[model samples]
Target: MSQIVVLDTNVLLHDPQAIFAYPKDEIVIPAIVLEEIDSKKRLADELGRNARSVSRLLDKIKEEGKLHSGIKLPNGSIIRVELNHRNFTQVQDLFGEITNDHRIIAVAMNYHVEQQALPEQERKQVVLVSKDVLMRIKADVLGLPAKDYISDPHLQADDRYNGYFTLHVHPSIIDEFYTYRYLMVHNLGLRHQLNPHEFVILKDELGTTKSALLKVNANATKLEPLFLSNDPVWGITARNAQQRMALELLMNDEIPLVTLTGKAGTGKTLLALAAGLLKVEDEHKYKKLLIARPVVPMGKDIGYLPGEKEEKLRPWMQPIYDNLEYLFDTKKSGDIDKILMGLGSIHVEALTYIRGRSIPGQFIIIDEAQNLTSHEIKTIVSRVGEGSKIVLVGDPEQIDHPYLDSMSNGLTYVVERFKQEGISGHIALEKGERSKLAQLAADLL
Candidate 1:
């Protein structure tokens, strides 16, 4: 039997083109979903942009045929808008409130009931696809099959790319690497292909303690020793091997895109900031340093607090300021602000206002990139003009977005998608340099 996929408003908002995702199955967009999408069309955020995108797509496709009955898509799927199946009695008891979620589930439940009455051979499985966890649980309680809208299946926690791996070889290979600064990829005789700019630790297969730290050259043909791996950036130095690898990628101007992922206290922000300052201030490589981060709140909204745009963002951007204060090691209050004002080249803007920007000749650092969706990140990266580089630094495991996870967030998405690209480099830092207590909390708590 074929399947009938019911999409929620969040699914469309998460991926505006999700209607084409299931080419072999019929897709049903609940009428309530249209209402929800309409409400979000004026959000002035990612969700609003997505709602508009969905509206435009639906508008274009509906011209083919009426959406209520069915619209035959080119992908061999039947798309329809569900207007008659919103029987609230079908799901009212499962969920107490008559919220939008309840209405969406009502449509799915009515479809399931109608399909059940048909012959077993003719009944199509009705499934709810959403990004909400509690909504999925509620649907399951109502005897409906629900799932997450996972675009990529290989982004699971265990299957993720860590940017570096240990290659155990004979002692002579290690000695040969030491004798010659660079070793050919064919000479290494590795089982798996190494990605461009990937880090490696050539270790001896025998129990002997011999290893060398190297990175894949841009061509992915040779393992070259770290060139700018140990250099201190603005008085900050790497305290570990992974951090050193991250530094190598950050300092390399040839690689235009970089990704750094780790847990809290891993110094991802500090390292990226230090590198940006070095490139923009000391080296004069770019015209300025542009740093932006998502304004996702942790606990509660500070809407009642009075302030302008800058003051309103203080609570959200405080973490960035804290890192700057420590990097400057200022002895007096507001000294970091004075220094930033004097620089005139460092702009720490909010991520909300990054749209329609054509950034060029700048060092761009996006902090907490995990909260951004794949589409949102794509929008930001596409703004990079010539002579500009973008560094995405975030801890995937620390995502706070309602619809994102370590496996599905934009940071991990970019890390996997760009792993093999010659213009990008990635590093996953495990060590936490903040403090022993913080590291312990990150690991144990």
Candidate 2:
């Protein structure tokens, strides 16, 4: 039996095409949802973009028939724009406000009540779907069934990581870590599941042997990587059987793009920056080093800042500056800027101008990439020229784009789409290396 689904304002604001997502099911867009979208259509940013997109979609659907009655979708599902009715009076009595949220609740409540009046066997189940947590709770209080809309197909729990593994080995594996770079350990008779780029710490079971870090290389076709780096990079070391596995992926220059996603203080940006610096500055493998990030306002924009382009970009780029300063240990801001500028090899350009330009033979780091739309991300990646390495780092859980979420954000989209490609790599850092307080807040708060 087809279900009756009432979408809230947030659903349309999050995804404009949500009306057609439920094929064969009756989808109803409350009049209040249209009012909310109309109000937001004049604003700027993703919310406004979604509002306008939803408006256009609704208008296009109107060609089929008047929305006040109903329209049959391409998949044969019925869609309608609900009209105001006595439902408002009951909702007002419960919610006691003429707010858009209250009106959406009223629509769902009325539909659910009407469904209940019919025989249980004949009535379609009325479900109010919303992205807003509070709105879902409100629906429950009004005796209407509600749920969070999970339209994005790729969204998974925060703990999801495709290329990772954990291993515990004896500390004596240090010698093997240095010599072989990988250990098969066939006779040891131990088997531990490992991900492509995961790390393992080996402690000596007999004596107080210092723990040796080992990485499981992603593409170690020749021999298992057991060799340990003289110094650990990104706090992950290669020890024991997985050492070879980790190195194969980390040092595999074949992979052009490497994305590290994690919550705040999880070392995603720091580790990528360090790796880029090592490859470009120390290794001299790439011709240039470039960094860029989206210019998203925290809560709101300061309108247009009266200044040059760089001045306008300063506020959003401040975090990047802080990272560079810390990485270079530069005391003065000018010192870091001077070094970055003097090294004609390094260029820090705004993402706005990266569309038409073709960047090649360079190491690119795009930080806080979660704010970008999928279209924007495609443009950025398409600009990469031959022999170019790009790293996109962001936390999906902390997205600011109104039209995106943990699953639909550009960062997650890229990760999911490119995971199978041989030329791309990804890592989800779990440990928070910033501070005890930062880690606590990221996990608890």
TM-scores for candidates 1 onward, in order: 0.94, 0.80
lDDT of each: 0.90, 0.73
Candidate 1 versus the native: TM-score?
A: 0.94
Per-residue lDDT, model 2, residue 216, is 46
For model 1, how does the per-residue alpha-carbon lDDT over 1-445 read when each residue is reduced to its tens digit? Answer: 5699999888898888899988878999999899989999999778899899999999999999899999989999999998886568857765667998898888898899999999998999999999999989999998999999887854568888989998888999888888988899998767888999999998888988989999998889999999984757899999999999998999999999999999999999999999999999999999999989988877765565678888888878888999999999989988988999998999988888776799999999999999999988888989998999899999888888877877778998899999999999999999999999999999999
RMSD of each: 2.0, 4.9
Candidate 1 ranges with C-alpha deviation above 4 Å:
298-304
Taking the tens digit of each residue's C-alpha lDDT, what string does model 2 give over 1-445?
Answer: 9999999888788778888888999899888778888999988556788899999999999999989798999997899999854468777877787787887888888888888999989899899998877888888887788987766644676645544443455655656766766765443355543434444556666566455555445542222443434365534433323223323444557778777777898766666666677778778889888888887776656357768887778787777777777887898758988988777776666676576789999889898898887767888898899988898889888987665667767888787777655577677766676788998999999
Residue 288, candidate 1: Cα error in Å is 1.4
